[model samples]
Target: MAATVNIRRDVRDSFYRYKMPVLLTKIEGKGNGIKTVFPNMADVARALNRPASYPTKYFGCELGAQATFNDDTERYIVNGAHDQNRMRELLDGFIDRFVLCQSCKNPETELLVSRDGYITADCKACGYHGDIDMRHKLTTFISKNPPKKAGKKGKKGAAGADSIAGQPGQVDGVEDEDNDDDELTRKIREGAEKVMTEEEAARLIAEREKADDWAEEDTSPEAMARRMAALGVSADSSLLAGDGDDDDEAAGPYGEFAAWVSEQKGQDANGLSAAELYKEADARGVTKKPHRLLPVLFPALFDEKVNAELPKYLPVLAKLNTSEKTVKALGGGIEKLVEAYPDTIKAVPKILMTLYQADVMDEDAIRHFATHVSKKYVSKDLSKKVRKAADPILQWLDEADSEEEDEESESE
Candidate 1:
């Protein structure tokens, strides 16, 4: 009987609330037929708020083995001699990919399969909606066999069976017919009550009456311009523009950069084929304040696998200072990108290293950036991931400092 532990151990704070059952595994069979059995998988999956089958299938996919779960027997098996440590590590990967919300890293999320056959996690904690990586084999399995909803028919059938079993005495045809009628009437009344509560019915009537009034408001360009003025942005603000055109220019540099970013939202890194946006920014002198432009540039320029292309952007990011204000802004932009694509965390270390090598950040600036934790960027667990990614660069900086101090002492 092991105590429950936090699902993410990196989040060491006492207030960190998410927990799951300690993995319980038993190795059975022998030789090539060896399989790892998860006796408490149902409990574990229940805590994670995902179907048990998902993690089971994920184990097979990651290990390159077969997995099976018996619904009737409550058994989960993976065809391998996976140790508890290995299984735990794989389970964390599964949680990162499937269970946790990409934005807040909270387990309070629901899996939604869109009409286009894409899976997304709708987070309740942060109101963030992000698409799941369709590249994973588990995504296909989930799409093919979505979790079944519980039905009321089973309970109704059980209730009827119990009612019949209670009557030991034999009943005539007329009495049986009367019982059926009574049951039908009861069900009808229950359904009718559920269909429209008094409060709900009243609200519906009020909304219908006001629908005409709502339709009368002007939707012309002049009215829209007035509303935009009230919000303190031009009519051509990127926030108001839809995701269609890329060439449409905005009134200011910030707005223009935002408009370009919106055009590249759903596109891949290759789609950023031309350096037109960068050239335009340079022409307009927006390159001087790279920190202000970071929010738009980072997302548009890089994809999930950003490490390979990260060096190409270094010359641009180098123009920005390593001051507190600039670092804070850059951190905020990076956090927003991570929220939308959690996998981007994998490339963060390389990105930081590149920035340091290019003189965009010094040891002091990197240390200052790492010490602060903000929920605006990501949750505690994800913030830990970012810190973990930056550890290599931090270590390098520490070693360099030690070497410098040694050299200074020798000179003295």
Candidate 2:
């Protein structure tokens, strides 16, 4: 019977596509001279597309033990009586750091040795090229003993010869025919060079001069506009009128709010109060169109312990969420916050519940927000966390609707 296990712990399916041989650990020696041997290290490393020495060395480094790999004997050993589970855990860490692509998380990667003596992993699956952590002890070893490049095969022909005998314009075992062909080829080239007339030479020279002159022409905006007009194409001046400052002005309110929030990072919010901030925002006309301020306000107003003091800001946020656009903006801002600080916003359900209870987010909006899943804010894992956090609110809303239906049915 074949023993197999999923490549990663996160993949729980018994029939997962990625499977590897179960770790086979054997203890050797006794007392202080204890050593662990991986008999099928070659096969396991082959499955991972890495050298057996890498994982073996990694185990040594992590466990503070000595490791050895004998290429001739294909033996890998670590100077400790480590259990199979512990070795497998260490191997997973190695795979996460060296084998997997940071961007796509795929294991189809090749280690590249740079000219500057740094190692990078180039992924074949997603074409992602990322620098490997140089801090690892294995990096130094990999740098010293880089993977060899595949050699090209030599063409099956005599040295300095283009074609073989009996092929186009060649005779079998004749050196004179090859030499005569070379001489005749040189003569044909010399005769062809003399065929050009003086007028044709002058015309060629004139065309060259014209090309050089065009190459040296000015490429400024006005010059380009004039050139386009000369070529019978229209150029619109209005398209390039802006001074590239509109985007900067558009971020003014959000930027100011963010700056204010940063300034209040460590201070006690009890002194300043959310009502004071709301009043100040209203004074600055930021509260009039709160959707524009939400992206900045949400993160600024709350931290990881948002649920503890969320009720204080509920009234202010509810008042600001006067329209459908503002509600959607607030939802999007929460999503961004969750993405940026997944750990801090683990109480996402409580935040959403506060909004729903305060009448800021209606049933439709809450349902839509609960169903929406996007990778733009965070990775797949964190995205799932955010969605999972909303489950409680979804359940509450469903129960409320059911109660309302029950009342209607009783009245009928």
Model 1 earns a TM-score of 0.38
Query: What residue runs in model 1 are displaced by over 4 Å at the alpha carbon?
Result: 149-412
Candidate 1 lDDT over 1-412, as tens digits, reads 2223456756753223344555667788899888889887876775565778899999999999999998678799999788776787899899889878889776657788877789988775567898999999999999987765424321211111111111110000011212322222233344345534634777688688869677886655565445434322245434344432332212345444554444454454444422334445655665555555564456545657677766544434433332355555666556655655678877776776655443344345567666666664457777767777777767776786675455334323
Deviation of model 1 at 60, angstroms: 0.3
Worst-scoring 10-residue span by lDDT in model 2:
165-174
User: Model-by-model lDDT, in order?
Assistant: 0.57, 0.58
The sequence of per-residue lDDT tens digits that candidate 2 reaches over residues 26-111 is 78899999888887776566555577788888899999999999867979999977867788889889888988789967565779
Candidate 2 segments whose C-alpha is farther than 4 A from its true place: 1-250, 374-385
Candidate RMSDs in order: 23.5, 27.8
Q: Global lDDT for candidate 1?
A: 0.57
How displaced is residue 196 in candidate 2, in Å? 94
